[model samples]
Target: MQQTKRIAIIAHNNKKNDVLEWAKFNRFFLAQHELYATGTTGKLLEQEIGIPVHKLQSGPLGGDQQIGAKISMQEIDILIFFWDPLEPQPHDPDVKALLRIAVVWNIPIACNRASADFLITSPLMRVEYQPYLPDYQEYLNHNYDQQTTKVRQEQPVSLDTA
Candidate 1:
């Protein structure tokens, strides 16, 4: 039996329609997996596609951060984000952060329709494929040790007769 994958879908305002169409085309396949989305996107998918979607806050209202947190926690397996490159976003930093976290966690991310198509059609999507993930704890420990050493090197020695 194939494990049910957790997938996140997000799209910019101008790309919502594109994502909707894509979702409609893949509705049957999508139904087999768990779905999550930002507020408006989730509502539209549930209403138009008749598929249940767990809705997070709107992107500008912290939805991207919420997704990023899920990726870090290893709760999300795939991310389909249809972001508009031509337009500037109010929460651009959040969007970049979310993408960065997804990369860091080794989550499979599809930024456009073509990538999504490739990912969806891959046989690995239905099977359990192990992805390499960086050891965040080890990274944190290394950083802490580096900082401790740096602080020690910067500290000044006290003179006698203090």
Candidate 2:
């Protein structure tokens, strides 16, 4: 079976044109995989490239958080985010969180056209490659244990003197 990658594409308002052009240039390559995008970007790509894109809500309207959730759940294999570094975003925290989750999950991510080109052209793009993912269950368990301990320590001791 051929391995198909689930790719998420996102672009800031200022970089949408750049992402559109890049997507057009790589349409053939991208068509082989599953595509997802934030609202406007998804509509633009679908209309211009004639490719199906799963559209999430607009970034400021929680689209970035949706993508972050997908990353955490391992539903996305790659992320192509053309964020505008020169401009401030109203949803900057969401963007950072999305990027952070991508890193934590050890997924491939491209922040620019150059990196996207490299990622799409790499031999591994056509083959199945396993990335090293840290075991987070241990961390979750540790946190839960610590919380339990803290709650136990904070419980009021019952004083019964009859």
- What overall lDDT goes with each candidate model? 0.94, 0.94
For residue 125, what is the lDDT in candidate 1? 85
lDDT of 1 by residue, 17-57 (tens): 99999999999999999999999999999988998999999
Query: Which digits, one per residue and each the tens of the lDDT, describe model 2 over residues 111-143?
Result: 999999999999988988787877989999999
TM-score of each: 0.91, 0.95
Off by over 4 Å in 1: 153-162
Tell me the deviation in Å of residue 27 in model 2. 0.5
